[model samples]
Target: MSFITLNITCSEEKRELLIAELSLFPFDAFEETETGLLISCEEADWEEEPVFAVLARYEVECRVERVEKVNWNEEWEKNYDPVIVEDQCIVRATFHEPRPDFPYEIIITPKMSFGTGHHATTYQVLKHQLQLDHKGKKVLDVGCGTGALAIMAHKRGATDITAVDIDEWCIENSEENFSLNGCDHVKLSLGGIETVQENDPFDIILANINKNVLLDQIGAYSERLKNKGTLVLSGFYTEDIADLMAEAGKFGLVHQEQTERNRWAMLALKKE
Candidate 1:
């Protein structure tokens, strides 16, 4: 299938917000540019109306182009760099040689999926995961783009994982990535948070979605967590921490710790 690219020029503030807004759509990859952001998705899944409608609200310049006969894997690998954190964790494409020195190395080809650990939100969450104990824990990865976070949890010794994403492309990309990493036990679910069965509660729930979705689903995360289970949240600005923390508190999830990078923050809350 061919891919379509969308270019939108907006203020830095609007760039991140637009990424969050557009993420709900079928877009698979997003890149922030000096002047704006570049978004890509399957040609069949691209919808001009919702994209332009969201862009119009923010008063950003928009351009759409369909790219045919493009080998995205080669294009991505040519430009993709390994995402390294504290010299400990490395998220790289398969083309990059493995780093045995790093305690954790995750291989994920960039198909424009969101959670490759390049973004500050994903980076902070990955760093936070390193600090938490995931041995034999049941984990849930909400908005599991590329299933990167779910794979990380597995490395930390999580035996059971449910990686859920609203985008089908993400699920497809995640399935491939999970296999690449030999994560056979990770359950890949394609649907909204509400659709996931809550009978099997999680010990650690990682959600790195936007503020609106996080707020709306805080209660659900609460309902799906085992007692004292931790919920790690990111994908919002640091200024949003208070609002998100307050909402999470209402669900009896107490703020335990926080980490920030590039103004994006990751918050860990424990079920009280």
Candidate 2:
């Protein structure tokens, strides 16, 4: 199926805000470029009036342009590259070179969207995953885009691990990556936390989804977590931490640790 590509070039101060705003839409995929942002949704006619309204809120000037239809999958694979973080892990495109030095390797074909691990949310989870004692423990990675963290946990010694994402492409890419990294035991599933019914009472639950999603499912994590289990959450700005903490407290979860990079934040909590 063909898709519409919306290209918007705005100022640096407004780029992040615009991206966050666009995320509310169900875009097939999106990318942030040096000059602006590019968004793709199933072929549709976008009224510039609404876009202009959104821009006015931020007082940012934007220029829109149309580009030729292209195969987004092929383009993403061609542009995707292995991203190494903290010299301990590597997030690579299936088509690129792999580095053995990274104890954990995640093979992700970004496709229309997802993966890349450059986002602070993914990086935060990756960093905290290193600090976990996954030695033969059962782990669950909810919203496992590209399965980067799930693969890492397996490599780190978590024998039974499951990675779930709503995107079918992400599930497919993650499976290919699991095999590529010699981590075949890790299960990849579609859907949200509901797929976790097959496996329950996990020793650790890792969720790096947005704030709203996290809050909605916070109870599910608490219910499925083994006593004394750990829950690591990211994908929200630092300012939103307070609200998360409040909600988590209701689930008997207390903040144990936190890490921040750029404007993103990660919180580690333990179930009482």
Top of the candidates by lDDT: 1
Q: After superposing candidate 2 on the true structure, give the runs of residues whose Cα lies further than 4 Å from its correct spot.
A: 1-27, 32-36, 41-74, 77-81
Clashing pairs in model 2, backbone N/Cα/C closer than 3 A: none
How accurate locally is residue 54 in candidate 1, as Cα lDDT from 0 to 100?
Answer: 89
**What does candidate 2's lDDT look like per residue over 115-203, in tens digits?**
45766778778878877899999999898776778888887899889889997877887787678778788887889997678346899
TM-score for every candidate vs. truth? 0.82, 0.80
Model 2: lDDT to the true structure: 0.77
Mark the 10 consecutive residues where model 2 has the least summed lDDT. Answer: 107-116
Per-prediction CA RMSD (Å): 3.8, 3.6
